[model samples]
Target: MTDHGPQPVERQLPTEESRALISLVRDLTQREIAPTAAEEEDAGHFPREVFGLLSASGLLALPYAEEFGGGDQPYEVYLQVLEELAAARLTVGLGVSVHTLACHALAGYGTKEQRRTHLPAMLGGGLLGAYCLSEPAAGSDAAALRTRATRVGDTWTIEGTKAWTTHGGIADFYTVLARTGGEGPHGITAFLVPGDAPGLTAAPPERKMGMKGSPTAQLHFDGVEVADARRLGDEGQGFAIALSALDSGRLGIAACAVGVAQAALDQALSFTQERRQFGHPVADFQGLRFMLADMATQIEAGRALYLAAARLRDTGRPFAKQAAMAKLFCSDAAMRVTTDAVQLMGGYGYTADFPAERYMREAKALQIVEGTNQIQRMVVARHLAGPGGAP
Candidate 1:
């Protein structure tokens, strides 16, 4: 029953270069950070030191162009790095993903001059970013955002509260989406609001059930002034920029989901083998062995789905639908696989003695972030139907 046949495709090593980077990341995660991840989680401490190590390694901006000191790696390569880091610690993996998402708004839409101005500190490290799109009254219905930005002279004054900002107070910069015209997505504009901008205040961190180490808070912008030069893309292009960035951001979250599931699966496998039940190793039993098999199968499917989307993106095709599919399927798979991992561990999984419970909690957040899975389904469905088609 414990047949280790054909080693599932998900566990296979990547190409030489990818394998090298993966190995390096895995070693860094396991050696430098894993030991402290649990304790930090317990104490609700975010790993600033870990972020410094990642920044020093030039991993903070791996997918950007090399001209800006970025690694210029492919999404495929970058995703694996995320997976490894996440397997060791969800907080670091998610922080990096959110930071990357925060940067995407500008990287994808900013002018050459804007890129020149911001890419250096963003890609060179020491500065982190956050994406601000959601508001108190608008979430999944992002187009309904009521935050307003009025142009006065060469500066624009923004007044709004951005809810659920990943790096709300801690980020060096924020990519904020605000209404510049009438209602709806077409009226929105995007801006690069400095963290210390006038009237920008971070609300106290929200008390979440998991991922306590990755802070989530709201940004209160009371007449936060930003130069017109700081605007990203042309006026009214905010929705397009936001959607495009989310297409890539969803893939990052998918990678994180896979990583979380993988960690849970690995821990369960190791524990079942070493954790005696009845007589011989519990892994020797057929019933529990089937559970392991299911976990492996689901994880492989989830990875394949995201990789397919990533490849589609790298090829410059219309990959929005595929990205949504990956995000939805992989996140659901993570929620299921991690839950099963916890179940397979029986009582210990329910306790802090094991990481399975933590994995379960972490997996849940992935479903909600980067556009909730419900939003992902809508995106996919819209693509499936032709333009002007019914929902």
Candidate 2:
């Protein structure tokens, strides 16, 4: 009777089935997503067809139960798929990640009836979801959210604004966290609010420096009514549910960061080999080669971090801290790698012709979202000082 921490019980590294799935997904992403990604991103249009492809491919629901028409794969495998998608088009990868985050509330804490009600559409092609945790004043301090969900005659009336909702206006539903009691984290409660629920209005999309294809907007809940049945978990479990979902969501961001870093590295490698300077290829320079080596090392280390965290999650271990570490380390590495990648390309990297500039923009957003890197450091530090944790 040996104890294995969050490693998946049935995990195997890149099995034949897994490899085949990866190959198919990679081909589809590269062919279908990469070609038009720049244009779509530039135009700020949602890649709606890409979502359809992902849903049809059984990828949008990879981390869910097989009973719900999901892939039911381990987080380890699912993250690799996320990395592949991100390497091709980060916007699509991010949308998938956000959708996964929204599903976490229903999947982890919802009643059986709630699961049956919401899981299918979420896992299906026709619907997308948004997570409502951050408020105008509460980004990292999610517990400080001011949104109120008051119980009145068996119905909950929600009133407050949720800021920075990915897929805000476009989502079919939102997993909302509101203050059901007093102040602090304990007063919070989670609910499922339909997009068309009366008094729920989404503001116009914010103009972001990057990840423009995946819109971010504020959700205004002005006396929006929801049935008591829409509650997720216990009355005060919203904060808990949000944290748990973020632990999983952090890993998704880590995978996407790794994908962005890998894309930058691959582009840098190709450009350095072909771009001639000083009577030879730029890659021939020992100084440039060393930088490339560093980039490769960072990418591999970041991948390893996320894989370890994913393994922890798959085996049902306490992975919140590790997931934070992975997200923090990978996003920072991505920022560094992509910046260096842009430098390595000399001039062309800065241009929109290559994907390097887009990678740079996309990398910065990951560092800020899913809990900022500063917040991630705080989580890791807490874990280090606690009983049986990292130091």
Candidate 3:
């Protein structure tokens, strides 16, 4: 259940270093990650040790600046690294993506002093992080969030409940968005809160359908006090900051979706080639063969689409539209590909002994992470033809 051989497609890397990095990541996946993926996921264990290993290997800081102890790799290389990790285990892949999202505020919007002070340890240190944006009432309608942060002279008190935080209970830091002024997007502010702040606490991890190895819970900031210096950006700019991070985070999710889809396709092809039907192998059947073709095609197309968006981001161009399209297409593709893989595997796919069932279950979360498929469509629509067709 833990094994996934080489992918059918060949990757194009910009440098030999990137190629070497991918090779190292694949080796680590097979030895350290894949061997325990099924057992740990089944037992609902989070592999903090594996994350520590990644941090030590410079895997955790691939996309940040080298000055801050990051690898300074392009988004293209960073995302492919994500695909390889997700291919091994979705829990690890998505966890790394969320940690990257958590750092976006500090890396992009923090004062230079803040960056110099905090980013090196976060980028290279063995500490994990989480992002706090959604609330009980504000999953998609983020501007409707009710979490409040009030000024008290040199300090600020944050009081809110952040729902669906990926590393809620175990994170060492949280990049939180809270209301600082009024009732809309413009009033929001971003803050960097330490995990052990006086009033910050996390609820028990949610009982999820898949990726149970990763913790997702509601974080309660019961009047957590932070020094004014901990503020991430200007007082009224958090929503913008959050949206910016999501643009990049959506690409991470897309890469992960492709990884899951690719793994499913590889398994289905292996199964069909080995299982015999009548006098010939199951792969000889045109009907099942066409299904495999479609699955592989979607996986390749999703990969291409995400890489295209990542390239745009790497070149410092506007990629929100492309990012949304990639997320919408790739996540949908993962769900479809995994579902087909399960169907093609027949009874074996439905059983726990095979990984097709687990892949299918994990694929469902990709469609809903970062942004729901419906939201992605809305974003693309807004890009192509302004809101309400006013453009």
Candidate 1 global lDDT: 0.85
Q: What is the TM-score of each candidate against the true structure?
A: 0.95, 0.94, 0.98
C-alpha lDDT (0 to 100) for residue 88 of candidate 2: 82
lDDT (Cα, tens digit) per residue for candidate 2, span 1-391: 1111111112245578887778788778767887788888999989987887788778889889987667888899999888888888899888999988998999889988888877887897567888999989999888889999999988999999999999999888899999999989999999999989999999999999999899999999999999999999999999999999999999999999998898888888878888898889999999999999999899889999999999899998889999999999999999999999999987888998888888999999999999999989989888887544432
Clashes of each: 0, 2, 0
lDDT of 3: 0.92
Best by TM-score: 3
Cα displacement (Å) at residue 111, model 2: 1.0
Model 3: worst 10 consecutive residues (lDDT sum):
1-10
Q: List residue ranges in candidate 2 displaced over 4 A.
A: 1-14, 386-391
Q: CA shift at 190, candidate 3, in angstroms?
A: 0.4
lDDT of 1 by residue, 1-391 (tens): 1211111123344477777777788778867877777778988998887887898888898999887768888887888788778878889988888888888877888898898889878877678888999988898888899999999988999998999999778888999999999888899999999999989999999999999988899999998999999999989999889988889888899988998888889888977888796788988999999999999898889888888888888778878898899889888999998899888889988888778888899999999998899888778877777555432
**For candidate 3, lDDT tens digit of each residue in 266-372?**
98998888889798889899999999999989988999999999999999999999999999999999999999999998999998787888899999999998989
Error of 3 at 285 (Å): 0.5
lDDT agreement with native, every candidate: 0.85, 0.88, 0.92
**Candidate 3 clashing pairs?**
none
